[model samples]
Target: MITAADYEQLFAHAPCGYLITDEKWLITAANATFLAWTGYTSDDVVGTFLARMMPMGDRLLHTTRSVPQMQLTGTVSEVSLEIVDASGKPRAALLTATRSVNHDGGVEHRVIIFSAHERRRYELELVSARRRAEESEARSVRAEAGLQHLALHDSLTSLPNRAGLALILERGLTGRAPGASIAVLFVDLDHFKSVNDSLGHNAGDELLTVVAQRLSSTLSSAGTVARLAGDEFVVVEHVGSATDATVLAERLLEMVNRPLEIEGLEVVCSASIGIALADDESSEPEKLLRWADIAMYRAKARGRNTWEVHDPSEVDPAVNRMRLLGELRHGIEGGQLRVHYQPRMTIATSVISGVEALVRWEHPTRGLLQPAEFIDLAEESGLIRELGAWVLDAAVQQGAQWSRLGDGNAPVSIAVNLSARQLADPQLACMVQASLTRYGFDPSLLTLEITETALMENPVMARKVLTTLKALGVGLAIDDFGTGYASLTYLKEFPIDELKIDRSFVSGLGTSDGDCAIVSSCIQLAHAVGIRAVAEGVETDYQRSTLLTMGCDLAQGFHYSRPLAPELLEDWITAQPPSVASGRAAGPGPAHAEPDDDVEMLAAV
Candidate 1:
């Protein structure tokens, strides 16, 4: 007869305090009673290492004694320890803990804290147990029920954990009307790691707490919402059809995608959802969770911030993802990687200002694969570091070769991308220095293009790494500028040389007045900061002309030349490009006299 409200009250007002921690001994959740006793708020402790809450001696005791005991036996007997209060005072308490594995494949522990003096009270109570049989029995029953409630609940969000979600799903399935069914929607927050990486774990926890509150409040009356683990949550509902569940899924995505401010930073994290419906045979909780998980991954793969419904007729992408990941590893090491260059034309002179090295995978069977196809794979598999290193080495070698060619018309520089993972590497500067020295490439001609997302993820670290790279006399560009919620403060502080306006705004040029304004502002912003403005994705004469008039310093897109193989790019360079704005050719090459046709084909498209 106990309801969720009853369990909440029980946990909040329990006679003893409680704390939960993940495998790493990081506090994940604490009950109100514990927070009150420790003079700390949930926010003060959650996402913080548990040892930090204790004094030096107690910390050592917990780490050396209690944690090992719990790990060996799944439980630790009451151990006397001193927990530090918010005021820097230590409070003596007895700790008893139990550890278990959650459905998400993570280990968690529940610790019940009791006052040290309570041990004496307990012995006294036992001495009078015969006289207070009824009282003791009632208390024992309540304590047992409290354990069940805590066991099934998530410490951080105070929502039903995985086990709790399974129980809810089971009840929904059995309690559904004869013709109705239960639906499970798996919601995974996108780019959450970036938030954590950039804003720190505290901010990530705050964001997760806010998100959990929103989802739970929105569905309080309709269905049950539970935290599955980390950034994943589940919503279970009783529905008549799949359409009903899917429609709800869309609304949930909107809720999750709305911009949020954690602490002082504004963040926008979208959710990719997967919905699964229960049938007569597949209505079990486990089956639905499995299917929904697979479908959620499908939503992510199809461009995140969307939803996907489980379709048995379709192939599960998990297996293919694994196979492709293996192939990509082979591609990088087995010589299937190719570096193509797209020319960057100076708007004023129409000269090939530089070339951005674009990586391609000449898969043994998949033909030529673009970055869009496997960049995420490489990123997720921790292979981006390896892949990026290879690209840097190859691009540097090629740039050095061209520099030696003495083709005064060849690109004056080459730009290479740095993934967030690569940027995070403490040794990134060293690696770049080694590569440049090995190739004997001019540091000035080796520009590094870092995405706004990557830079913003950890600006402090990015700045540190960038300062070192900048010291090497290489150009640093903020790639995909204006696409992320970047602070102008950091932009001004970061040691950057250029801002590459994202292609989206350029694509809308001459059509969307808003886009035109944004592009102009970006160019002006870059110029104001004494940095060149580069426009990406310019595909038409109109787009080109608008940017040129806007005083865009440089541009690269299909209007001039598509990204071509090294040899093809060399040919394009030798073909001589015309002064795009004046329709006059300048370089000493074969197409030096080629008149401007429809639009300036700087080289060959």
Candidate 2:
């Protein structure tokens, strides 16, 4: 509705400066506002390259960066620049530009400039204020002592994790009074795995969530409750005496003992509690956590739904460890350690592909102990090297014996776990070669499995070690594959033949969308890299079917069979069809063992 003259007036006197330039950035036209802002007449700016009016920093950005970008992309926006005015003073400006072709077939640029002096000053002031406030808050936080970060929180329960619990211990120790002591309570749920096995993992997760809420609400702010792992939680607080700690633990037991409705079923799950009190000012964090753990196990040993307090007047954990170490050395010499084999199946062919060797300690009085009970101890005490060697030699000898079964016997590979400590030794390859030679076992029939986390710890060193072992012609596998942060890049880099998907993800195959996607991607990734993908800890029929559909090459878990004595495994094999017994099964086994033991999940094998 406005006249042509009115439009002309608006362009000349617009709030921001406007200019037209040829492809070379030589100004062909400029609005009156542009000349006024620069304190220059038409004669001073017309026919001059825009770069000449910019400072060195902005000149380079305009010509070398912004101009080229606009020419290619057709636009550039909000580029902050410092321009030189007629008086040779620098002015802060925000620039926006666009490129187009004129009717005469020549390229032209339309440039818009906004004076940013006041806005830039305001932004600087705001940034300065923010930094000062942060500094003051940080100083106050430091005065209050160690505080756990939000990142330390668990994703599932929103409770603090193991690392956060350490910080809580630190802060608690720092503020303790003269003679007063602090207590760490270890809480472990009893028969928790039954919930998972019966109602599935979803119900198990719900029960855990409810328990976390109950514990947090019961303690309020008096104590800190942290989830150490699946069914383990730790409570840290200041207490006057051992008696007081006992009272607190009783309250906790009551809270956990209450029946709750999970998945439409009323479930009564109780906890065993272990309390460790440290009165010494110099007590280490590891000492307290370990003592609490040992006490918790004692409570479990006595019976569930009870509490036990660690008393130094009795056996010390460290002393007990040393004694146990000595006993283990004798146990090894006395032939007390036993090797059990868990069968692994070829998913596609239904063939009994191989068996993984799992070690068990026949601790005279302690009966049979799982690897979890003492593997960490052996590793820390530097005895794993000996333990590992024993397992390797024993497994190789056993494999050689099976190999002599002669014709029609399906060839079976024996897989042995290699601990991180063993992998670091320069002589590991030599030991492997020696074992193969002594037993006359086929190098191609032996598979060595290393955990993904262990391999990624010191990759350069792991690669050097793994390369040496690979030269011996044995297969290599990345155990617990999907649990750690390892990528396909490293997967391809390592000379591994198989990827064992971690059981944590496999368990959720029928329920968790995220887990299913991860499992599928892992299988595809392994296939793409020309490696076989295996799933570990598969229990349900649904999980097995899902993995089969995804083309998993191998699998092992309680769904097939628990690790058994050699003679028992032989019986199990004899019960199978002739095809299965010959390791050339034409179809899947008629049935696999489904165990009722709630503690089977805790077994590393």
Candidate 3:
């Protein structure tokens, strides 16, 4: 076990690659294991420098740094280097070296080499994994930021949306300094539908994007601009007073009015702005937004491209209008709306030919209310269609009653006014036919009166609707004629049975020649088309006489009587002179017609 041959065999066949280097750093000896691992024979590595096995950079480091460190410490453990094999391929290795004094007093290095390929590969994988994790974390942060941006901004314009506007307004109102006033301007583009209809939606979107950019530029650092859905934008800023709001609104209007180039087309647009202000911390966000919305509508009503401030004193009107609208709906459902009939008389005969059915609301507190007080509100609130339907049903029922009670010659036809919304309703013809059928009334006894402006709103659709109504044997009359933009050619196109001249022109009768000419021409035009002409607002006897002389087919106004209840109308008709009831023209009688002064005529039936 202690033989010299055994020791020599152990050194030649060690577990690690064993090598010996002289003081000059040349390999003096290499074990069989080292030669085999490096694909080199012992003879090839015995006289070669150990640095020769490394890459040039590693070779320099081993020569200069490793050698000196090992000399000072007498050892260099686990020095990493690249070794060249017999085939000239570099391989990773960890070398442990020890310096010792040989018999000649020269320093020699004893080295043990280990393959480091797996260790190097593991380190590289760890570095790559760390890089991937960092990239993933960065991507996640960016994605979260992008989602937040999208939630608050309009995708098309990149402007803040309604929610974003609310948040900004909330913060402004909350953090505002004492005595500071914040103004919120609600802006709605005027006639934006025309642009969308004419230029296509893609162009409309482009226009909206450009509008957002322009608004942002114009209000830079002055306020926050937000898009509140479809051609509506809002601006929030601190203002000094109402005058400041007005000035700012004017500036916004000017900015919006500038021509925009979108999709290679020049477009012009305008906006109506409504401004609401908060001077104190007590202001609520919802209430401010609502006030701005109401004011915007007021601006629209005043004609577009204008600004209106919400006045606290005038708030009752909008409130009252809404209250009246609710009451109207209630009245219709509860049968509180009474249909009063005003007799229409033939001008030549002075006899009642038909009656115009007018709806009267006997308010529980304010007494009887006229159509002028509520009809416009009803139309604006989208309640006119329902009101129109109720009126049609009531008029048709009354006409049926008249048919049942009257002789063959008695006037039984009824005229009911239709609002523009009713005229535009696709179900209007069907509703009329259903009412006529339900009441068993002849269609000839029902005349639907539409204003000239209503028909002109959508002429093509109006023509189709009118033609459909005419086919149902129901009469159609143009109410308040000559007050709209209807030309003679346009008039001739409608299948009308009568024209009720607008009271504006009739009020000027016997006073203004221009008014008289308009009235005369309207009557003549009606006659030329074989349709009856009815003169409205005939108050003075002279006006009635003049209309009779001008050959107006029919007339109705206070001259005959104010609108009367059904029972009172029957009594009034019976009390008329036999000659007048017989429809014979009266020849210069009293200078003034008797006014019906009865206020408490009938209770709710």
Candidate 4:
């Protein structure tokens, strides 16, 4: 194979170039593709060493002693080279080379190269396409993962939500093998609302994220931890003993209680833990969660920062909640609920301007009940939508009755308080319109009162509702103003007709100078905004005097009259002087009070 005749044929007319060298990396053999690729013919390339074709850095690698060693090792896969093309432009390629064998069974030490133009281009295109596909797949994966994460997580804290925890509990309870059990520990942060109220929701969210991380870190080896809305979290320990779960809960509480540096402020909150056993025999995930919830409430009741195991025999709060919801539903439908009107008096004249319609529940066996007893229960159970509708209708109907009963121009405006839930309700506008039409009462005579917190909960939505009500010619008042997180902000956003100073501030108006200043400022703020200021729960003559002196527009409390039935209200209004009735002769509306506090109280129902 090393014959001169063979060499001549290989160089002149052979399918490939051929050459031999003594243990040195001297050129060897090259095919026509290589010649065309490098713009060199046999005369210029045949005896030239491999170093001339290589870059300076690789030139040493193709020296005198390297060719034989490479031949001994056989072919190498995918080796890179930088060679100049016919145009002297740099080209990249992957190559494989093998040593040629001779008839004498000795290594001829010849080299052969297959030009990698098409193969290299194909490989590079494949690599590029693979990279693109990987990037696209990575983006798709990330987006889907983000959506899935959002679906199961709280938007505020990026922690798993109640739905996620339910799934985890289900899997933990059902996926376990025979004899395996799961312990679900429900955790609630103590006084978290105070933190939210005092530090704002942003700080509250930061605290929640920190608390979530701490809970996660605490259960790193124990089980999975998930947030279940608000200040509630759940820890599920699969195949764990009760004692292990209890220890995990204790550690979790400890971790949660650790001070958190949120926005450069140090804050701490204790956690209450409720533990429930979920053995393989359990049928429902809710049962386990219910047990844990019960235990958590028990922990909270026992002074918080503690853990408690679920007690099966005790009355379940879940059942009570369900019962209360049912009662609320029935109470609205069965006419077991009634609206009692409390007269609002003018601060100077003690004359009644309007009545605030308060709801009372007449439980079949529980006698008459204040709204505080069941209104929150209704809100918590999401029955406020229906209950609130009923109250609105009742108040409107009563106002209509008062309008029908009183002389013309004496339409008694009825002010009904609305919860945040009711104001944010999408149907609130329609409901008000429907109630107004149903009772054939003038919308202008129905005053809808909402707390300042209501506006902050969803300002844009609440504004829309208030605007709709205003367009309907109904009066909208911000109830419990100056006692919420964003009273000024609310007043700026919503078109309010009145500002009801919260009872907390009104209770100390005369005694506390700070209270007086606050009341004075509030009245000024309200009037400056073209809204009337009303004082609620003005129980003392001094409070009345102070509010009147401050130019408060309206005042209401037992100092005028407690919430009374329609009959008593009519009789009381008729007892006013005839000239006052003549002053009320605007026809079809209630009489306006010039502000007084000597109105007698009705006996407590």
lDDT of 2: 0.80
Ranking by TM-score: 3, 1, 4, 2
Worst 10 residues of 3 by lDDT: 596-605
Top lDDT: which candidate number?
1
What C-alpha lDDT, on a 0 to 100 scale, does residue 217 get in candidate 1? 67
Error of 2 at 538 (Å): 1.7
Model 1 scores worst on lDDT over the 10 consecutive residues at 596-605
Candidate 4 per-residue lDDT, tens place, 1-605, comes to: 49988866565554332335334446645556567767877677767766566665445455433444475575444456666555767666554555656677655455444346666566688999999999999999999999989888888767668887777766666667888878888899999998888789998988888888887776657478787778888887764588878887878878887887776878888989999887655547788888899999889889999999997778898788788778868878898987676767656556566666677888897789897788778777788877877777777776777667756323366666777887777788888889899989877667778888777777788788889878988777787778666656667778887777888889987568888888889888987777778888988888888888788877889887778777776666677676544433432121133322112111111
Tell me how far candidate 1 lies from the true structure as C-alpha RMSD in angstroms.
Answer: 24.2
- Once fitted onto the true fold, the runs of candidate 2 whose alpha carbons sit more than 4 angstroms away are 1-315, 407-411, 582-605
Please write out the lDDT profile of model 1 over residues 1-605, one tens digit for every residue: 99989977887788788888887778888898888888899899899887787787446655658867876899988787788889999988888889988779989988888866666677687778866897789899999988998999988889999999888887878877677777889999998888887889999888889889888766647599999899999998777788989888988988887898887877888999999988786778887898899999889989999999999667767778999999999888899998878877777667666666788889988799888899988899899999999988888787777678765445546667888899999889999999999988778767788899888777888899999999998878888899887877888999987788999999999889999999999988887777778899989988888887898877899998888887887677667644532222232211212322111111110
The full ranking of all candidates by lDDT, starting with the best, is 1, 2, 3, 4
- Angstrom error of the Cα, residue 183, model 3: value is 1.7
Candidate 3 per-residue C-alpha lDDT over 1-605 given as tens digits, one digit per residue, 9 for 90 to 100 = 49989977887988778999987779899888888888998788989887778778445655657778886898887667778888888888887788999889988988888777544665687899999999999999999999988999888888889888878888988888899898888999999887887789998888788778777776648589899899989888888888988998998888889997876778899988888898774478777877888899999989999999987556645677778888888988888777887777767657666666688887777888887878778888888888888888887787777678854233466667778888788888899889998989877656778889888878889989999998998778888898777887877899987788999999999889999999999988888887778888899899999998888877888998988888888877778888766542222211122221111111111
Q: Count the backbone clashes (under 3 Å) in each candidate.
A: 1, 0, 0, 22
lDDT comparison, 2 vs 3, better candidate = 2
